[model samples]
Target: MFAGDQNGLQGDPRLKAISEAIRVVPHFPKPGIMFQDITTLLLDHKAFKDAVDIFVDRYRDMDISVVAGVEARGFMFGPSIALAIGAKFVPLRKPRKLPGEVISEAYVLEYGTDCLEMHVGAVQPGERALVIDDLVATGGTLCAAIRLLERVGAQVVECACVVGLREVKGQHRLNGKPLYILVEPRQLTNCSAPSVTIITRRDQLSYYSQDSEN
Candidate 1:
């Protein structure tokens, strides 16, 4: 999707629509956090469809066999992309969320430690996989998803997220997995409202302070 790179994406019209559709809800889930709410984006059928279609068009010919979505928000984009690309959808869920026997991998989040679980036989060795998530704040969740797939012997071709946010300096690299992010938000602070420097993807909304204030 990012054929020419970030600079090229800066000019791409598809991403612009997605970006506009994403609303920055100030102090959501807590104070001082400006959350990028994707639910609104999901509601805009044209924008939502464009977001999914962009991903489908990119991976359609990439020989992707498995689409592993990090639980919750990843579920939103993952299944759509998987169906379009002719890949099976695998959910990497929160602890105890999966009914069957599962394997787990732990990772650190901006707040605390958490883990992701996948069904034992959900994926096969050597199958090409793509991990999708709604946001990549610290990259912990996505990394865990990638490791979980790798542990099961599946080859993860890349990790894809709706947002590519670089808050910490050079902290989001897990085994150098390639990340394909659809939108990198342009931080818009109100200057009048309190601002924080962190954003977490809670599937719903977590807060960070990059906003377009009126």
Candidate 2:
């Protein structure tokens, strides 16, 4: 069983709002997987707003020059944080998704190898960037994003995610870059297939399956 570590964001009402908004789906895309679905969270206006507000409050004072968001879900939070922090938002896309000259970085996933790309000139050298994603599992995608930014000479300030699977130890792959997350996974039982308790940013509580190995 995994112990709970709330990252000290516990007890904040905003954490409760965000926690309540998420929908957990079990055995999604595969068996023994519990997917933390943010689409449900997006439906709640107040909860979504609170999620953005939490990120904005953190980055507003940091002189961030770019917000590099991973393909889809990161799109939800990256633009808001970029706008709030007076920075530009850049999308790190999947293979061949963008037009014009591009740069690519390949990384390992839980299943296989994949690549991420960005427009060649989207970010200038020496810019400070923050990488955003919906969650961090094995950290493969975020590592690719960081490499993409560094290839352009952009300094990665940090990586942010809404949720993290503690067992995966994705944070270790960050090359010492800081990772900020709203929730962390805690195992609820001693069974081989355990359910998980999620400790929200404000230490608000919720539960989901631990089936997903990512």
Candidate 3:
């Protein structure tokens, strides 16, 4: 069991199962990028179930009323957790994808800005929400999703992901909201293979900023 300053995950066998199931593709969509592919993980039923079970076990007791999944991948884990925890599943979609009075939030990416949209009446004031995503790279997408939920008065309980890239430093932009993740950043090496590391709490978000000042 890995421990950190915050709430820790104990004796979780699902972590290893998930890590082994991911397939890493080299230079996908660009050069010098290792893409962590979950589709391969999805193909393995036991691995996929283990991944969802880890999240469901953690959030099942929490009073999360809505599970908001980001555009594509989040749709996979969000619905399962939502159903397990007895919450409604809401889709945080891409631009112009949702119809009928949608609310949108724009966030900065390493290259530029992109927008995420949600239906206007999807969340009500004071409702509790949990944001789900496959991975946290630069955090722009998740940040945008959080803003969209908060803009309409929903309280975002936390952001959850299967993997987090510490080198990318997107966790810094989460605005102090707790991010629960199964795999830590250090475990993912530069090699062209998918991997997973032990879980840990992200206590600070200004790691990149502090490095840049030096």
Query: Relative to the true structure, how large is the alpha-carbon lDDT of every model?
Result: 0.76, 0.75, 0.73
What value does the lDDT take at residue 195 in candidate 3?
38
Residue 75 in candidate 3 has what lDDT? 94
How far out, in Å, is residue 187 in model 2?
Answer: 8.2
Clashes of each: 3, 8, 0
Error of 1 at 113 (Å): 1.3
1 versus 3: better TM-score goes to: 1
What is the lDDT for 19 in model 3? 71
The candidate maximizing lDDT is 1
Clashing pairs for predicted structure model 3, backbone only: none
Angstrom error of the Cα, residue 137, model 1: value is 1.2
**lDDT by residue (tens digit), candidate 1, 12-79:** 78887888888877655666666667888999999999889878888999999999998788999999
Error of 1 at 75 (Å): 0.2
Candidate ordering by lDDT (highest first): 1, 2, 3
Model 3 TM-score? 0.83
Which portions of model 3 miss their true places by more than 4 Å? 1-7, 185-214
For residues 1-214, what per-residue lDDT tens digits would candidate 2 score against the true structure?
A: 1111445566677776677677765444344445567889899999899888888888888889999999888998999989888999999988989999999999864346778999999999999999998877667778889999999999999999887766667778997888888865333233344464332211112223345432
Residue range with the least summed lDDT across 10 consecutive positions in model 3: 198-207
